[model samples]
Target: MTIPSVKTILYATSLSNHTRGVFQHAIDLANVYQAKLIMLHVLKPLSDSNIMAIQSYLSEKDIQKIQNVANQETKNTMKQRLADFYQDEMAGKNLPEIEQIVVKGLSRYAIVEQANKLNADIIVMGSHNKFGRSSATTRKVIKHSGRAVFVVPTDG
Candidate 1:
């Protein structure tokens, strides 16, 4: 039997208060396994109806500009979050190499898609332990992902 090796880890975050704890777990696993870590944040795309409503009041060029700005802002926020994580958690310590990205889609699907795209060995994500149960989204991501999922429990 061949034992599975974790060479790449996909860490999906909602960027909430619980994110830091989850991220720490991801980093720890990467450190132990000497794996490359990829941090992903999913943004749900605008619904068709919402896009139509906005389009009614704005030109196509204006809409494109808005989308560009929104995407840039989200990328900026993701970078800052990573910076804060390193400063607050790692300090002067050199962590395993990490790549951060933001993509648009439904949360659960997007995470799985990114994991597949990156060919990640395992997915590390946080599950809100509310009422002694994991969050539905966490369950869905596990259900949908073909790779191993390491869920870190967090207080929401």
Candidate 2:
């Protein structure tokens, strides 16, 4: 079998254990095809109503403090996770340009938008095998993505 020349690969992850498998796949493909690897994590935005409801339960100062703490923790966690993944799995390998991106938005939409912006040749994503029905997000990505998507089964 011939491997396609993957110039750029986008790996969308939710920081799940399953996503680690997706990352591994992306790394292997990147090494094989000499493709740039882009790691993307999307954070869902809290709605105004949701924020208001949470704020109502606490003093303004307390709410601000909590929000600041949460934001800082999230940033730290993401940075550490990305660094660990790279060091443990991707380091010492002749790989293409590797970039990590963290964006706040809906996961699937954010991934599709980034893929388009980057002109990615392939997207590697992990999927759970309980296939009763596809999620709205999954359907949307399948419909809208111009690039090919390689779904790695989480359970497999």
- Candidate of highest lDDT: 1
List residue ranges in candidate 1 displaced over 4 A. Answer: 1-3, 129-133
**Per-residue alpha-carbon lDDT of candidate 1 for residues 1-156, written as tens digits (9 for 90 to 100):** 986788999999877765678889999999989999998888889999999999999999999898789878888887888788888889988699998888889988898888989999999988873344577778998998988999998887
Which candidate achieves the best TM-score against the true structure?
Answer: 1
Query: Which tens-of-lDDT digit does each residue in 53-77 have in candidate 2?
Result: 9888988899879767766666677
Candidate 1 C-alpha error for residue 8, in Å: 1.1
Local accuracy by lDDT, each model = 0.86, 0.76
- lDDT for model 1, on a 0 to 1 scale? 0.86
Model 2 gets an lDDT of 0.76
